[model samples]
Each structure stands twice: as structure tokens, then as C-alpha cells.
Target: MLKLSNETKVGILTVVGITLLVLGFNLLKGKSLFSHNKTIYAVYKNVNGLMPANAVQVNGLVVGSVSNLEVKDKDASQILVTLTITKKIDIPRNSVARISSDLLGTKTVQVDLGNATEYLQSGDTVYAATDGSMTDALKEQLNPLVQKLQGTLSNIDSVLLTVNAILDTTAKGNLQDAIRNLNATMRNFTHTSASLNGMLDPHNGNIQKTFDNLAAVTGNLKDNNQKITGILDNAEKATGALANGNIDKTLQQLQQTANNLNQTIAKLNTTDGTAGLLLNDKKVYNNLQYSLGNLNKLLEDLRINPKRYVHFSLFGKKDKTKPLPSDTAAVQQ
Candidate 1:
């Protein structure tokens, strides 16, 4: 190495010291001097306290830092921010860089990833957004609730005013009476509920006893299940035999017999046969009645005068006596 003067050595040492100091200060402020990072841009209406060197996060992981911020328009209404991402991750073109603040009021740019296949390149502009501050968010959330409360208060005020207007002496008395009746009704309902509870008591209730009886019946049925099954099997076999037998032929014969009987009865009713004529003709009935009466008289006379009907003696002696007048009259008739 060449020998250097004291002034040159001192100047070089001072320059090195200054550079090292600058690097250390930037590192402490979350900036890497020799980082392999890409630069992207975002425009926002407000940064919400975002500053240079603030952390740029993707899903809460710090991947880079905000590099710069500047106003975009002459009116200073929009701000343009520069971001440098050190992480070698693809950020989509439609990704949002939202400036969000923590509870401690420190702000960072949170990248909400999008589903675009085309990714951002160096100097690309991402969509920018600003999350509401804590106070602003609370105000936003409470606005509708406050309005609802106001409306409810107004309705309550109107109701109270109308009630005050309507509640005169008689109406107040009627309301009191109605309240008393409601109380009485409530008491009655409570009593009825108590009675129902007692009636439904498991220990000493009729319903419980009925349920026990029903359970006992079911138990009895369960005990006789085999016998009942056997009876049912016998009944089924009997019915099957009847079904497999000539039941249709038997029924047809019975139906034919019944039809013949009905036809015979109809013919009897119309005097179409001898039996029908005997049942339906009055002259034949009268003649049969007269013949039966005469036969009965003749049998009665023979019973009374047995000597006239039969003669039996040891000697063949003829014994004759004058017949009775009633017998003669009967014979003449």
C-alpha cells in the first residue's frame, strides 16, 4: 500500500464513519440499504398518519417499508405513496394497499391480496385505501344506533303524550279495574296451573295410575304373546283352508239355492204352481177346510158309537139300535 498523508487518512476515515453512521441509522429505522426489493406506487386520499419507513405488511407479516409519500394534485387532496417490498412474493395488480392504524396509533400499510393472475411489477401502482381511525370507526358504527335511539325516544314521547291525554278520571279508573281483573285472572291461572301440576304428579296422580295400568296390560300381553301367536296361527290356517277350499263353488251353490228359493217364493206369491195355488186360492182353502171339518166329525161319531162301526159277539146275533138324532143329522149333512 502507498503511504498516505495524515490529512488524507483523516478525511477518508471521516467519510467511512459518516457512511457507516448513515447505514446504521437507516437500519434502525427499518430500511435495508442493500435489500433486493421492488418498488411499487399507491395513491390515497389520506395516509392516516403513515410515514416513510413505516412497515408494509402482508397478513401482519412485515415484508417491506413505505419508501416515500407526496401529494398527487395541486389541490393536495390525493397523496401518492411509494412502497418497496423486500419479500420475493407476487403481488397482484388489483391488490389493495390500505393504511391502517393500530390501537397505539402507529400506522402501517396492509396489503390485502387479490385473486388476479397478473402480478405487479416494479413501479406498478396498487389500489390504495385508508381504514377509518378508531374514533372514526366508533362514530360510524354508532351513528345508526344513535338515530334509532332518537326515533325510539320520539315514539315513546308521543305515546306518553297520547296516554296522558287519554287517561282522564274515568279512563284511569277503568284501567285500574282492568288491572285488578288481570291480576285476578293471573291468580286463577296460577291456581289452575297448580291443580294441573298436582293432577300430573308422578307419585299419587290418576294419570300416573292410568299409565301404570296401561303398562301392566302391556306386560300381560307380552306374557301371553306366544299363546296369542299360536291362536293367530290357527285362525290364519283355518282361514287359509277355507280360502284354498272350494269356497267359491260352495258360495255359488248357496247363492243358486237362495235364488231358487226366492223364485219359488215369488211363484208361490203369484199362484203360478200347484203349491202356489194351494197357498193363494181362497176357494180351495175353503173346500179343504170343509173336508177337514167333515172328517173330524166322522171320527168323533165313530169314537162315540163303537157298536155301529164294529160288531163282535160269541153268537152271530144281530144287535140293532136306533141311531142318535145328532148322528143322523151329521150323516145327512
Candidate 2:
């Protein structure tokens, strides 16, 4: 190898320094000189401060950078932006590249992947959109609130004017009196709150004692759960037994008995049967009465004249006193 002159060596060093400087600058700008990156295009009405070398992110991760921007038409009505993706991600053809900004106003191209099996080629155009910047978003969010606040202020102004128109010296005095009453009501409410707090205190309150008593009752109920269950089970079994009994058959029997009794009563009300005749026929009743009287007299006679009825003399003589009614009947004959 031939040795170089000082000037040539210096020139070579200068070129090498320049090349390294360029490489360093590109690296700082997030560009890989040797990277096999994919290039895609997008058209937008506004880029919203998207610059070349701005980070192109996919799901919040920086995968590439914005490469170039150019006005698409003579009127500058739209812009064409070029994006370089260094990763091997399969971006769908329908994917959108939205220009977004952070809180610090650092803009980025956020890639929103789409659901399509067909992927974008290196030179394909992605759909472009501009997300509202932080300021724009804040303005959009606060506009309604501002409108409502303005309306509220106007309504309050109107109310103030109305109050000024309506409130004379006497009305002002009454208003002051009302405010004083409200303050007193507030004081009363404060006292009531203190009383309620006292009622709710755990150490000294009747409410707390009532709660403790309720807790003890619940504890007792829980302790006697088994006994209560047994009682309920026995009651349920008794009710089940009653439910399963032949109540319909018993009712049928009772109804049949009532029917029979009713038939008996009906027969007794008629003079067709002997019982009916006895109960319902007056002639039969009189005859029965007479027969019962005769029976009673016969019984009394036997009791009084037992010797006439049963003669048992040892001398074999009859009771010859002329049977009681025989003499009287013979004289009469």
C-alpha cells in the first residue's frame, strides 16, 4: 500500500467526518440509513403541525417517522404527507394515519390499524385524518359549559334586576327578616344534627342500646335456629298429615248421615211409619197414653193385692174373703 500525502489524508479525514456527521444527524432524527422501511402516502386538508421526522406511532409505540409533506394542488387546498415505517407490521389497506399532538404540542402521526386481510403496499396511500389538538379539544369540551355559564349569568342578571325592581324599603326589611329566620333555621338544624349525633353515639345513646338489644335478640334467634326449625318442621308435618287425610271421604260420610237424619225427620213428620205415627198422629198418641196408664194401674194393683195374685197358704185354703170386687159385683147382679 502506498502512503498518502498530508493534504490527501486531511481531505479523506474531512470526507469521513462529514459522512459520520450526516449519519449521526439522521440517527438523531430517528432515521435508519440502512433500514428496509416501507413508504406510504396520505393526503390531508391540514397536517396540524406534523413535521418530517415526527414520530409515526402504532398503538402509542413509535414504529417510524413522517418523511415528507407537500401541497397536493396549485391552490394548496390539500397536503400530501409521506410516512416511513421501519417495522415489518402488516398494516391493513384501510388503515388511517391521524395527525395528533401531545400535551407539549409535539405532533405525531398515529396509525390506527383497520380490520382488513388485504395489507398496504410500500407505495399505498393511507387514509388521513387530523385529531383535535389539546387546545382544540379543550375548547370543544368547554364551549357548551361556557354557553351554559353565559346563560346562567344572564338569568342571574335578570333575576337581580327583577329583585331590584320589586324590593322597596319594606320588602328589603322583610327579606332581611327572612334571611335572619333562615339563619335561625340553620342554627336549629345544627342543634338537631347535634341531637341526632348524640342519639347515634355508641357509648351513651338509647338508639345504640336499642341496636344492641336488637343484635342480642338476633343472636338469640340464631342460637335457637335448630329448635325453631324443628318446630316449623313438626308444624309442617302436622299440616301435611291433615292435608293428606281422607277429609273428602269423611265429609261425604257426614253428609250421608245428615241426609239420613233428614230423611228420618221427614218420615217422623209424616204418619206413614210407626215412629211417624207415634210422633205425628194424635189418635195414636192418645191410645199410647191410655195403654201406658192401664199398665201403670195393673202394676199398682199387683203391688197392693199380692195375696190374691199369689196364694200360698199351708192349709190349702184359698183366700176366701170373697175376692174384693166379687161381692159388690154379686149384689149388683
Candidate 3:
């Protein structure tokens, strides 16, 4: 009976040990005590900061953990990473994986379920990407600025040395004379400014009259403010009406008018129409010159012999006009 009791105790302990081992395995796989999960693989170029057992996230939520990492092929260019995520995560077939981190180097695998209607199956491989860290970017951006600042500081030092040399040279020369001249100029400026202030005093009648004129102008502007506002309102309404009206039709009409004007200008540039002939041909210009010459000749004739064109008659009979005796005597003399 004692041997049977010892055998039963051993069996009970063995069964408990087996149950504990199963629970530990489930916890290590990141699963519930009774649930199952799916495994997927992704490959990366440089998993520099990534390690095994790092959490995998989808949209910043922890969904899985890395299970294994190894060289994908004989070529060490790519590294393979296996993830054991929950079965609830429906990763797409064309989903991508990338290494991400916070401000610190706390790395994780980020998954992107791309726009695939079909979901990823177990043992499917995800596309991998690598984005560099912000520290590298900041260093790259600051390098040139630091170099420029150093160059600027060197230039400033050279400029300061040259300025000091010039100042020392000036001090050894006629600097005292320059200082005296400056003092004299300052005194003259003070006197001139006092004279100007006296002339511009507010109590002066001319200044008072100028202020009164300005006040009158401001008063007039204030009185006309309503009229100005009304004009502006009317202009705004006209602009708004033009904008809200058939603007496209108006633009079409304007285009048609422009086309007609262009046609007219083209005709004027050619020798086909009357205006075109006048503008482009020389015959019309010659005719105009000839007509002007004839007009001048007619004027000269009228000036020389006005009696031929001008005639006078008395009320009852045709008047026989004769020159006055004094004008005739003057002509004879």
C-alpha cells in the first residue's frame, strides 16, 4: 500500500510540472493561455538597432513581437525577421515593415497594411524599409552652418584688425584738427537749430495761419465724408454687379470686339481698304499734297486780285466802284 501511495504522489507532481511548462510556453509566445497566433516574416536591409524580441507595432499599437532574426540568404545584404503576432491582426499581403524609434533609440518594427483587398496568410513575408534617425539628419544640416560661422568669425577678426590699424593711423595724423572742426560744426548746428525753432514757433502768425488752413481742410474733408462713403458704396455695388452678372458673356463680347479691332488694324496695315490705302499707299498722300498746293495757289491769287472774287452792288442798280481820290493820288505819287 505504501509503494502505491508513493507512485500516485509522483504522478500528481509530474502532471503539475507539465501544466506549468505549457503555461510558460504560452506566455513566451505572447499568447493567451488557450489561444493561438500567426507568424509572419519580413526582410530588412540594415537592422542596425533592431534585436530579437523587440515589440512589433501597427499604427503605434503593440501587436506582436519579434521571434527570430537571421541572414535571409547566403548574401548578407538582407536580414530576415520573424514576427509572431496575434491572429486578430489582418496584415495584408502587400504590407510593409519598417524599423522605427522614439527620440531615444528604443526601436520597434512598424507594419503598414497596404491597400490590398486580400489579407496576409501565415508564413507570408512582409516588405521592409529603413528610415534613418533624426540625429544623422540634424548633424548633416548643422555641418554647413558651423563651417559658415567659423569663416564669418575669421573675416570679422581680420576686419577688426584693419579697422584698428586705420584708427591708429588717423589718431597719429590731424585727428585733433578734425575734433576741433567737429566741435565748431556742432556749435553752428545748434545756433541754426535755435533760429529754425524760433521761425517755426507756434505763436508765429504764419504758423498759426498754416495750422488754421490745415484745420479748415480737415473740416472740409470731415463734412464730405458721407459723400465720399456714398461714392465708394456705389462703386462697390457696381463692381459687385459686374462680377455677379454674365461675366463670361461679357468677356466673350470683349473678345469679339478685340478681334474686330485687330481686323481693322490689319486692314489699315494692308493696301486693300480705303483707310488701308490711305495709310499704306503713297497715292493718297501725293493727292493730299497736290490739293494743299492748289489751295495755297488759290489763296495767293485771292490776295493779289481780290476784286475778281469780291463784288458789290447798290440797292437799286449795279454799283460802279472806284478808288478814293486820296488813295489814287497816293498810288500815283
Candidate 4:
């Protein structure tokens, strides 16, 4: 048996302990004790709370860890993140990578195996599709709603102001008068209704009898409806026949009469017709005026010299009798 010094035993124990710590650290880094790490690239628009040393997973299995994050090009609007993963995992070429969060709110990089036959080689770029965070999604959904709510509030304010103005105007002017008139109208209506109720009291029996009579008349009309319809149909057919033949002839006669009247009116408007002469001729009016003037002059001569034309003697005392001058000789001489 070899004898070991205490210092040598402590040194050996320290070496073993250091070796175990190294192996544990490598295991925690997602690397086997002797396995090599494969470098892969992940491109993202937003890292979204991801950092280095965060685990990379594929189908919920830990495969790698995020190594670095760097902006590839400021103008390109992209971020390039590098990852060191286990060589045993075969990431497909068309695989998509994304940053996701656990239920406990820890974020990590996740790989989605795409439909590709070949696997991803070292330093291959994995296209990343960034998912909107809960906050981002809520903002996206609520922004338009907030805008609509703002517009609705503005419209409601406008409506309220308009209603207020209308109420103010109504209260300032005709509202009281309208209320008084409405009250008076309501009172009058109440009185009239009371009077009508008294008039239609059950003790009177007149209203009930009238309604009963009306119902009976309506029932009788309903019973006679088909017969009345048949009679009306027959009367309508007869009237239609009469209107189609005799009424058409009568309308033709009336049209002819109207045309005759129109022609007569046209003739009366002519200058040579008797009515047209009466209406349009000035010589007839002048002759009438001259005849009227002569008649008036003759009437005046008769009124002034009535004794020359007629002599009336109450007493018959004749001293001499002389023959009246011959009327024709006096006129000619």
C-alpha cells in the first residue's frame, strides 16, 4: 500500500472537485463533456426580452443556448443572434426560429422544424419570425377601438350640447304656454270623456243597442257578401257593355258637339259674322248712338211743344171754326 501525505490527498481532492465543477459547467452550457458545439445564426426583427445564455429549444427540448446578439445592419432593420448548440441536434435548413416565453415568463429561443430534407450546417442562418408580445397585441387591438371611442364620445358631447340648447330654448319660450295648453286640453279631454262615459252608461242601453245593430248589419252584409258580389259583377258587366258601345257613341257625339261649338266660336271671332260684327264693328255702335240722339231730341220737342201736337179743351165754346192747315202742304211749302 502507498502512503499518501495529507497535503497530497487535499490536492487530489481539489483536482477532482475542479474537474467535476468543470464538467457540470459544461453540461449546464448544453454541451457534453467532450462534444463540440455547432454555431448557428438566428435573425430576428425584435429579440423581445431574450438575452445571452438563454436556452434554445426545439419541440420543448433544450438543444442549445443563445451566444450573442448584434445588429447586422442599421439600415437593414435586422438583428443577428448567434447560438451555440449541440451537434447531435439536426436543425433543418428551412427551420424557423423565434423568441418565446415560458409560462413563468422566462423567454427563450425556439426552433420550428420546417419541411426540409436536409439539416442545417454550421454557421447557417435560421430565419426568425417574431411573435407579437401580449402588450403589443393588446395595443394593436385597442388603438383603433380607442380612436372609435374618442369619436363616439365627441359625437355624444355634440348631441348632448344640441339637446341642451334645444331644452334651453324650449324652457325660455313656448314650453310653459305649451304645458298650460296641454293641461287645459287634457282637462277638457277628461271632461269630455266623463260626459261621453255618462252618455254611454250601461243604464242607457243605447250604445249597446247601437253596437248590436251595427254587428247585426255587419253580419247580414257578410252573409250577403257573395250574392252582393255576384250582383255587382253582373251590374258591372252590363255597365261595361253599355259603356263600351253606347257610351262610346255618346262620347263621340259629345266630341262632335264640342268641335261644332269650337267652330262656332271660330266663326264668331271672324270679322264678317254677325256676332263678330257686333263685337268688332264700330259703325253699328255709331248708328245706334245717332238713333238714340235723335230719339232724345224728338222726346225733348214733344215735351216743350205738347200744345202744338195736342189740344185738350174741357169747355166747348167755339167762336170761329178754321180748317187745320194740311200737314203735307205745310211740310212741302
Candidate 5:
């Protein structure tokens, strides 16, 4: 074994140490010195939790890392971040760089390559975007809820103050009185409920009888539904007949009959017919009365002198005895 001098040993150690340091620094920046890569720039208003050495991925595959970050403008409102991508990765012209975080809050840069045939060069620029992490998202969403909770708490405090002021007044007596009234009302309601329960208890037949009667009525109605429908149909038919001039025809016929009767009464009153002559002519009436009186006298004479009418002679002794007109007249008188 050859022994080296101290200066030479120190020089060799320094070179090895510098090499290790360079390798460590490259590893910390997520860089592989052995592999070829390209660099691109992205400008953003906010990088949100992005840091150097964070993985730059395309479609969830690790392609590069965030190399460096700086303020693009003097106002420091805009940040320009450098991304070192693999040389073999062909990024399209319209690619987008977005900063996102995982569930562990580890930030990353995700590249969404467009479908354009034109590709981005090594020193091309990209527009930067940010996606809120779980914490930031929750904070943004819960901000209104927090404000509403604060308002609710403030309202509750005001209500408590008002309630305290109310309790400090002599109206507490009225409140207590109202409470007592409410208790009394509650007791009365309890009694009413008990009484109602007694009336409607399952063992009691009153409610059942009512239900049975209702059921019976419903059954009767159901059974007689066709009969009722028939009656209604008949009534509708009658109403339709009345509405369709049947009643009018009846009234016309009645009117015609009444007119005929009125004409007959006029004829009777004017002595233009037989009934009219008999009812209105006094001379004919007197003649009828005299004829009836003469017929009655003739009938009476026949009944009294039946022997004169029924005379019989068996032998031929021809002695004829006849009734005289004067004797008949005298008898009539």
C-alpha cells in the first residue's frame, strides 16, 4: 500500500466532499444529472403552496420538478416559476401548468398538454393556475357559515339581554300568573282527554255503534245506488221532456179545448144551437112545460078510466057506449 502525503490526501478529500455535496443538492432539487431534461417558465399571480423540488407531473406521471421561483414583476404580485421537464417529454403548445395539493397538503405542478400538433420549445412560457387544497377549500366554504354563526351568537346575546331586562321587571308576576293559567289549562285538557278516552275506549260500544251505523248507511247507499241512478234518470227524462216542448204541447191542447168550450158557451148564450135554444129561449121553455103538463093529465085519465078503454062484448047485442070529450075535459078539471 502506498502512503499519500497530507496535502494530497486533503485535496482528494475536498474533491470527494464537493462531489457528494453536488449530488446531494441535485437529489434535493429532484434532478438527475445523468438524464437529459428541458426547462420551461410559468407565470402566475399566486403559486399557492408550491415550492421548489415539488414534483411536476403530466397526467399523474412524474416528468419534472419546480426548479425555481421568483417575482416576475416589481410589485411582487406575480410569480414566475421554472419547471424542469424531461427532454423526451413532448409538451404541446397550449399546455397548462396548474399548482395543486394532495391530501397530505404536498403541493405539485400538474401539466395538462393540449391536442395541438405544435409543441413547446425548451424556453417557452406557460400560464400558471392554482387549485385550492382541502384546508383552503374548507376555509373558503366555511367563511360564510362562520359569519352566520357569529350573527346567530350576537342575536342570542341580544335575546339574553332582553330576557334579563324582562326578568328584572314586575311583569314577572303576570308571567307567573300566565304560567299558572297554562298549568290549569293543561290540567283541564288532561281531564278532557280522560273523559274523551272514557267515551271512546275500545271496550265501550258507543264509538263502535257509530262506526257500525255509518257502515250500514254506507252499505245501504251502495246497495241502492243503481235504484237511485234509475230514479235520477227518470227524473232527467221527464225534465228533458218538459224542456223539449211536451208541456207546451199539453198547454196548447188544453188551450184549444178551452177555446172550443168558450165557443160552445157563446153559442148557448146566443141561442144559435139546440142547447142554446133550450137554455135561453123562454117561449120554447113555456111550450115544453105545457106539453109536459098535458101529457101528465092524459096519463092520469087513462089510469082512472081503464074500464072504458078495456070494454069487451061476447054476444052481438050492438049497444055502443063512447066516452065524450066533455066528460074527459070535466075529468081533467
Candidate 6:
């Protein structure tokens, strides 16, 4: 091989460098020099940070790239964009392309392949859309978490405020008062428990004796149950008899007797009956006393002078000539 001069070598190197630069620039803009490419147009209201060189995907696989973007109508709010896809891939006429965002905010184009039998020609207009933006997606995903975090923070703040309030002097005093009241209640409960325990103590015997007595009484009642029932039956029969008008007849008779007694008492109180006169007449009492005295005197005189009053003789005997003082007084008169 023949060697060139320095200038010619330099010129060749510079051209090669410039060619590499051009190729790199084209690659950075999503152009492939070695592949056949097809261009398609789309309209969107917003591209959402979609730029040229952004990847184009069909069914989640990278197949092409976004090549251009433009504002088609400011008044209509339409944005036109161009996609460069591999010419070998047939896109259906009814396909739509949507711009999307990744976790890193890098943009992409996703094509929704359609079932239409008709295929799209190169340079034809396609449908376009975008799923908001990276920030919007992040907000959508994190909203509930953020709200929960805010609520947790609010609860923590309230708890801290409560702690601060509880640290105050008045709160301390109230707590102390509550403790004192609790202690007092505990003491009262202790006293009550002691009193109850004393009453229940086995050594006291009183409670046991009372229970034993009650048991014995209950046993006796159980043993006499038939007798008691018989007595109760008799009482019930008597009550039945009284209920059959016997009690009314007896009551009537008792009332008549009471009326008679009342009338008798009234008459006796007025000195109309014999008992009343005997009880009330002082003159009759005096006459009875005087007659009793006279009878007593006559009995004594007869006892002393039986011969003067009484005479006797189956055969006539000589009459004694006894002269007493009363006989002589009578002769003189």
C-alpha cells in the first residue's frame, strides 16, 4: 500500500471524525442509519414531556422512537407528533399512540395495536393521547399514604398537647385528689369486708346456731306436714261451715243476746229491776239490817227463858211459880 502525505492523512481523519459526529448526533435523536424507518403522524392535547428519541413500544416492547413534536392548533389545543417505526412492522390503521412516564420521569410512546385487517400506510395520521405526567401519577399513588401520614401527625400532636396539659398544676392536683378518694374508698371497703368477715367467722357460733335452729324447725315442720295439713283441713271445713250461713245465724243470736244484755243493764242502772233496787235502795238495806237485829235479840231471849215461853206435859205436873221482874212490873201496871 502506498502511504499518503500528512495533509492528506489529516484530511481523511477529519472527514472520518466529522462522519462519526454526524452519526452520533443522529443516533442521539433516535435515528438508525442502518435500518429502514417509517413515519406516522398523531395529534394530542398534551405530550406530557414526550421528546424525540423517546422510545416507542408496541405491546411493551421497544419497536421505534418518537421523532418530532409540534403545536398543530393553539386554538383547538391540539399537538401534533411524529413517530418513527421500523418499516418491516405493519401497524393497523386503527392503532392509537399514547405518551407515558416512568419512575424516572423518562417518557415513552405506547401503541395500542388494533384488530383491524387494514394496515396503516407510512406518513398517515394516527390517534394520540398521554397518561397525565410523572408528578400526577406519583400523586395518584401516594395520596392515601400521605393522608394517613397527616392524620397520624395530627394524632401525635393532640397526644403531645394532652401530655402538656396533664403536666399542669391543676391536673396534678386533680390526680392527687382522685388518688385520695380511691384510697378512702379502699379503706371503707376494707372496713366493710372486715365487718362481714366478723359476722361470718366460724368461731362465733351464733350464725351456725341460728342456721341449725332454722334447719331443725324446718325438719319439724316437714315431719308434721300431714298433721298440719289435717288441722288446716279441719279449719278449712269449719270456715266452709261458717261460709254456709251458720256464722250469720250465730252472729244474729249473739247480737240479740247483746241487745238483751244492754236492756237489762239499762234497767238495772235505773233501779227498775230487782237487782237494780237491791243495789240502789238504801231504805231497803236499812230495813234488812233492823230486822236482822230484832231477830237476833228475840233468839237470845228465847235461849235465856225457854221455861216461861214453852210449857210441856203429857201428864200435868206442878206448875212452878217463878216470878221474874217483868212479871211483877206487869202486875203493878
Clashing pairs in 5: none
Error of 2 at 224 (Å): 55
Q: Of the candidates shown, which would achieve the greatest TM-score relative to the real structure?
A: 5
> What does candidate 5's lDDT look like per residue over 223-274, in tens digits?
9999999999999998887798678779999999999999988898988887
Candidate 5 displacement at residue 14 in angstroms:
1.6
Ten residues in sequence with the least summed lDDT for candidate 6? 318-327
TM-score of 4: 0.49
Q: Please write out the lDDT profile of model 3 over residues 167-276, one tens digit for every residue.
A: 78657466777889999999999999888787678887566778889999999999999999999999999999998999999899999999999998999999998888
User: Alpha-carbon error at 99 in model 2, in Å?
Assistant: 1.7
Candidate 6 local lDDT, 1-333, one digit each (tens): 998999999999999999999999988888889988888999988788788889999988998888888888664478788888964788888888988887888899999988889888888988787787878877998999999999999999999999998979999999899999999999999999888787777767567678888999999999999999999999999888778867777889999999999998888777676778867888876888899877765675566556557887678775554554444666899
| Tens-place lDDT digits, model 4, residues 160-197 | 99878877865757778888999999999999998888
Off by over 4 Å in 4: 3-6, 16-22, 25-29, 34-37, 43-45, 52-63, 67-80, 87-89, 92-94, 101-106, 112-119, 169-172, 175-206, 209-333
Between candidates 1 and 5, name the one with more favorable TM-score. Answer: 5
Question: Deviation in angstroms for 2 in model 3?
Answer: 6.6
TM, every model = 0.45, 0.49, 0.42, 0.49, 0.51, 0.50
Candidate 1 weakest lDDT stretch, 10 residues = 318-327
Model 2 CA lDDT for position 314:
92
The TM-score of predicted model 2 comes to: 0.49
The better-scoring model by lDDT among 3 and 5 is 5
- Over all chains combined, what TM-score does candidate 5 have? 0.51
Please give the distance, in angstroms, between residue 203's alpha carbon in candidate 1 and its true position after superposition.
1.4
